[model samples]
Target chain A: EAGVTQSPTHLIKTRGQQATLRCSPISGHTSVYWYQQALGLGLQFLLWYDEGEERNRGNFPPRFSGRQFPNYSSELNVNALELEDSALYLCASSLLPGQKNTEAFFGQGTRLTVV
Target chain B: SQQGEEDPQALSIQEGENATMNCSYKTSINNLQWYRQNSGRGLVHLILIRSNEREKHSGRLRVTLDTSKKSSSLLITASRAADTASYFCATDAGLRGYSTLTFGKGTMLLVSP
Candidate 1:
């Protein structure tokens, strides 16, 4: 089966501009999660969407927001991007909650470069 | 932060040897998972150990979790060049019925032939 898929493998945006990253979860998956892996910053959770609802988010600012569509695909929007916003944004998908031994599958991620 | 922190930020070992990495988290979790990420690639799930479990093994990988200490360890035996990558430990806090994961900074392992 095809794993999670992300669009525009790489993106470049100028400071103060906005950027949008997209992700399509694996088939039959209902939960999509966004994560930012900035250089030397590790992997930070950005948002979590389940059943078309925002379930949880990390300590990131409001500028980092995203939404999940009816089909379980997700879009992450970074508003007024800053140099610090440059990072590899990853998307992962997993089975619905309450499932036993649930494991998340990740996409290759989009490399966002903010100048 | 509830994120896990990996020990020995980086490690170098000769191929065919064993490599071990440790992770410590700040909060109680429902499960702990290990992931491997090669350069410029997405992470690959390695193993998952639940809070109730102590140790588990898959192929040549062994994972041990000490809930009392809120620490976990991963051991890769007979390592190969293919094993060189950054290893991260993620915790599923399972807070409010959400399976959200908090990841560690990761340990970089380099295996030379």
Candidate 2:
């Protein structure tokens, strides 16, 4: 089965601009997660979407937001990007974590370079 | 802040030697998992140990969890150069009906031939 898929392996955006990153979850997966792996920042959870609803979000600012579509695909939007925004954004898919814990499958990730 | 924190930010070992990494979390969790990532690529799930499971083994990997200490350890035996990668520990606070895993900064392991 195909794993999670992310679009635009690499992206470059100027400061104050906006960037959009897209991800398609594995077939049959209902949950999508977005994470930002900045230098020395580790994998900071950005947003979590389940069943077309925003389940949870990390400590990121409002400028960082995203949405999940009806088909379970997800999009992450970074507004007014800054140089500090340069990082690897990853998308993962999984079944909701509940009675039985579920493991998430990740996409290769998109390298976002803000200048 | 990430709930999980891994010990030994980086480690180097010979290919034949065993490599071990430890993770400590600040909160109670439902399950813990380990993941391997080569370079900056996507992560590959290695193993999952439920809160009730004390230990689990898969192939050359062994994971041990200590709930009292809120810590876990991962041991990769007979390591190879191909085993070099960053290992992360993730935890989920499952008390909530819906929850997500919080990943640690990760331990970078380098196995040399």
Candidate 3:
């Protein structure tokens, strides 16, 4: 079976513009998570969706938002992007926690560069 | 701020040698996991150690967790050039229903042949 997949391996956008990143989970996965790995910032959780509902979010602003679809695919939308937003946006998937297998599998990530 | 932090920030070693990296976290966690990232690519899960467990081994990797100190160590035996990557430690802060991983800045390991 295939692992998590992400689209647009690299993305470039101007400041104040909006950006969207996509991810597809493994066949039987039900949870999707978004994380931002910025320079010196490490990997910080952004948003999480389970069963198509937003379950938890990190300390980012409202501009960083995302949703999950019925098919377990997820999309992350960032509004009014800034230069600091340039980082690797990773998407991961797994069965819901407490389920059979909860170890998350990650995607190659979308490198978003805000100019 | 990140919940976990890795020390040494970077490490360099020769092939056939052993490499060790350490991670420390502030909050309590259900499990601690290590991941390897080749450059900026996706992360590959290496191992996971539960809070109740002290140590676990996989192939050439040995991981030891100390809940008392809120720290963990990862040891790679017989390092190789292919082992060069960024290693991160992640802590699962959620309880039974949900889990969110907070990762450290990671330690960059470079093993030369």
Candidate 4:
């Protein structure tokens, strides 16, 4: 089966601009997760969406948000992007939340560079 | 939120040697999972072990979990150049009804010939 797919392998934006990253979950998957991997900052959880609802989010700022469509696809929006936002954003999907008989598969990720 | 913190942020080993990475978390967890990520690529699931289980093995990968100590370790036997990557440990907090797997900073492993 095809793995999780992300669009715009790489993106460039300026400070204060808005950036949107898109992801399509594996077929039949209902949960999508967003993570950010910045230099010296490891992978940080950004948001989790399941069944078209925002299930949980990490300690990121409010400007970092995302939504899951009815078809289970997801989009992550970063408003007022800062140079700190320059990092690799990954999208993953699983059968359900947690480790309850579910394993996540990640996408190639979108590398966002903010100048 | 990130859960565990992996030790030996980076490790280098010779091919065919065994590689081990450790992780420790502060909160209680129901299960812990390990993932591998190639440079500039996405992560791939390696293995998962439940709290009640002490050890589990899959192919060349072995995982051990110690709930009392809130620590876990991943051991890759017969490592190869292709095994060079960053490994992360994710802990799933087994709350009443809501549980989520939080990942760590990860350990970068470099296997050379």
Tens digit of lDDT per residue, candidate 3, span B18-87?
9999999998888889999998899999998888999999999999999999999999999999999999
Q: Between prediction 3 and prediction 4, which has the larger lDDT?
A: 3
Candidate 2's residue-wise lDDT over B1-113, tens digit each?
A: 88899998999999899999999998888899999999998989999999999999999999999999999999999999999999999997765322458899999999989
> Residue by residue across A1-115, what tens digits does model 4's lDDT show?
8899998999999999999999999999888999899987888888889889898888899999999999999999999999999999999998856446467889999999999
TM-score of each: 0.96, 0.96, 0.96, 0.95
Deviation in Å, model 1, residue B69 alpha carbon: 1.6
Please give, as one word, the docking class of candidate 4: acceptable
* lDDT string, candidate 2, A34-70, tens digits: 9999999899888888888888888889999999999
Off by over 4 Å in 4: A98-101, B94-99
* Candidate 3 runs further than 4 Å off: A98-101, B96-99
Best by DockQ: 3
Residue B104 of model 3 has an lDDT of 93
Q: How well does candidate 4 match the true structure in TM-score terms?
A: 0.95
> For all the predictions, what are the DockQ values?
0.57, 0.59, 0.60, 0.47
Chain A TM-scores, all candidates? 0.96, 0.96, 0.95, 0.96
Kindly list the per-residue Cα lDDT of model 1 for residues B1-113, writing each as its tens digit.
64799998999999999999999999888899999999957999999999999999999999999999999999999999999999999998865333468889999999999
